[model samples]
Target: MPSPRNWREIPARYRLEAARCRGCGKVVYPARRACPACRGQEFEKTMLSWKGKVVTSTVVQVAPTEFQMEAPYAVAIVETPEGARLMTQVVDCDPGAVQPGMEVALVFRLIRREGHGGILCYGFKAVPAA
Candidate 1:
């Protein structure tokens, strides 16, 4: 059971919420207090488009202990049309097939289970856009 504050702090993990900096018009994901581009404090909430293009990607042959079972996966930096970029796992296809400029759609999925409680963590994963 996550606290309300925990959930509130990460709307982007669940809903793709982002912040548009009023100062520089930069859109940042995982909405932060200050804009990275202009160091602005004012922002307007925005929703990122579910679809994006992979800017870069790599096939993970080695993974941390917690993720070894899911190794040989593809990790990519995806950029939305709004200019928000996020690192996300790419799934539902061959890892070797993922490449830069590939189109993908962000989808809500289980990331992993944590602790003895096996609390399921959920986040977005990118899949090949049909």
Candidate 2:
């Protein structure tokens, strides 16, 4: 259920694809043409690990219209083993239970339905690591 502009991002969204800067070794999510840290143009495609730890978390009591049904969910910045941090919703547990330093695993799940037609959108969510 992604927008037309987001259709091109399916690879990164579904597979955790990232671009690593050859000059600075910085990893940028969703891929990029240039490195934000070093301003370097040379990059290599990399895949992020599914395992990570929550660097920060927040409970969302209010959400966008598209996600109204899922209000009061936990959202967090999860840092992967490679040091790539990405924002994702924390699911499959109590929202208030999410905390910084909590171990989590990236999971593929439904994000939301787009528009009135109910086009389904799939992406990654974080769950408490077993």
Candidate 3:
């Protein structure tokens, strides 16, 4: 529908990094700028696989003013291999078909167009794995 992949898109630099607390086992996605569990500032950049299962999901039947046309889209919280859970949209499959525990793969995708004069946001979306 839009350009294949917009760079200015959201997460233009969605590097899959996680912060596993050196003080604790709790991990943060996007690699917390700082550890929330122990307030520990030290962290190692760990790459996480996009592969995961749908932990939870909801299909929007009526989009919001910010996402009007996107209504009826399936959104989910995916649990990654690194154990970090992330909230995102489920694409490439029927929204009605989305369900918990469904295997999914992450992909960079366009999310929304800013009103009138703004950048086209893009980010990762999970889809049924082929």
Candidate 4:
């Protein structure tokens, strides 16, 4: 059986489902409900590269009630060479020093609590690329 963390991010981790617009060839993250580029309804599922560059970022000082203890986490909008952008949290670094255009590699991380059974909800997070 897959761990609770792996079960939740199955689409991203296993299938890597994303949308590639049939009209404009723009890759949309998470296989959007609608294409943002050409506003077309037609799409083809595509997988994303595990590498990307930070476009912009910020450190969240105030987190949600569930994530209150995880405050000061770093988040960023990253652009991949395949023309897809991802909004993900940056890890393995000083949250205060995250910068635009920094190269990052994809990694699965514990995002939050899942249940009373010590379950960890995992999702993709970015770390500095070596």
Candidate 5:
């Protein structure tokens, strides 16, 4: 079964929706209730551009129980053109190939299956930008 929190984040996960603080022009991903930069309470909904650059990355050699089969994957903090950064797995390439400053594009993909019932979860993954 999908967690209630995951259900609530569908808008950000599926559409790359972000909140832009009107006061400071700060763009925050996953749509926060308040702006962290300027403590602004008002925001405007904005859609992030699919393309971004890897700000940092790490290769996960040891995986959690759910992701053991996919061990040695690369996870990275990607920054979109709108300046919103989000952590996501880098896919469709060698784990070591992911590097800082590497360009990437967000793509919808199967994230994982939840629980014994195997409820499928979908989310975006970063792939090398064409």
Candidate 6:
């Protein structure tokens, strides 16, 4: 990601900071100006739980150029206890082993490096909870 884009997402990507719409009590990640549910402009900042359960998952057999080396990895939509869902890579286990309702803990990890500049991007990856 570009520096500007990456920097703007540090709160959500690094701290799991999110916004809760005051009008409808809806939560959204990456804190937007308006709520998708109610178009409410008023919001309060909130932090998401580090733990969640996999809602759904898929194995990527063919990967994009940036992620080719990690092909056949598992990606899932994990729903935190607060009811906020985010798509993340499920790591530290066999990709095919990831399943719906599986408990996972988010851990900080290197996401990817930008081309040429090698700017390191860090984000959360889900690992099976013991």
C-alpha local distance difference test of each model: 0.92, 0.90, 0.77, 0.82, 0.94, 0.93
> What does candidate 3's lDDT look like per residue over 1-130, in tens digits?
3444444322423766566877776677866557777888877666678789999999988877877777779999999877888888887789989999999999877767755776676668898998
Best candidate according to lDDT: 5
Best by the TM-score measure: 5
Count backbone overlaps in model 3. 3
lDDT-sorted candidate list, best first: 5, 6, 1, 2, 4, 3
TM-score, per-candidate, Cα-based? 0.91, 0.93, 0.78, 0.84, 0.96, 0.94
Per residue, candidate 4 scores C-alpha lDDT tens digits across 20-125 of: 9999999988776678878888998788888899999999999887678878899999888888888988988999888998999988777777556756666788
Give the TM-score (vs. native) of candidate 6.
Answer: 0.94
Model 5 per-residue lDDT tens digits across residues 12-118: 99889899999999999988888999999899999999889999999999999899999999999999999999999999999999999999999999999998889
Q: Put down candidate 2 lDDT per residue, 2-88, tens digits, no spaces.
A: 488668878888999988999999988867787888999999999999989999999999998877889899999999987888999
Candidate 3: C-alpha lDDT? 0.77
Off-target runs (Cα >4 Å) in candidate 5 are none
How many clashes in candidate 1? Answer: 0
User: How many pairs collide in each candidate, listed in order?
Assistant: 0, 0, 3, 0, 0, 0
Residue pairs with clashing backbones, model 3: 9-122, 10-122, 60-72
Candidate 2 local distance difference test against the native: 0.90
- What is every candidate's alpha-carbon RMSD to the true fold? 2.0, 1.3, 4.7, 3.4, 0.9, 1.3
Alpha-carbon shift of residue 58 in model 5 (angstroms)? 0.3
Model 4 bad stretches (over 4 Å): 1-9, 13-15
lDDT of 6 by residue, 2-119 (tens): 7788888998999999888999998887788888999999999999999999999999999989999998899999999977889999999999999999999999999999868888
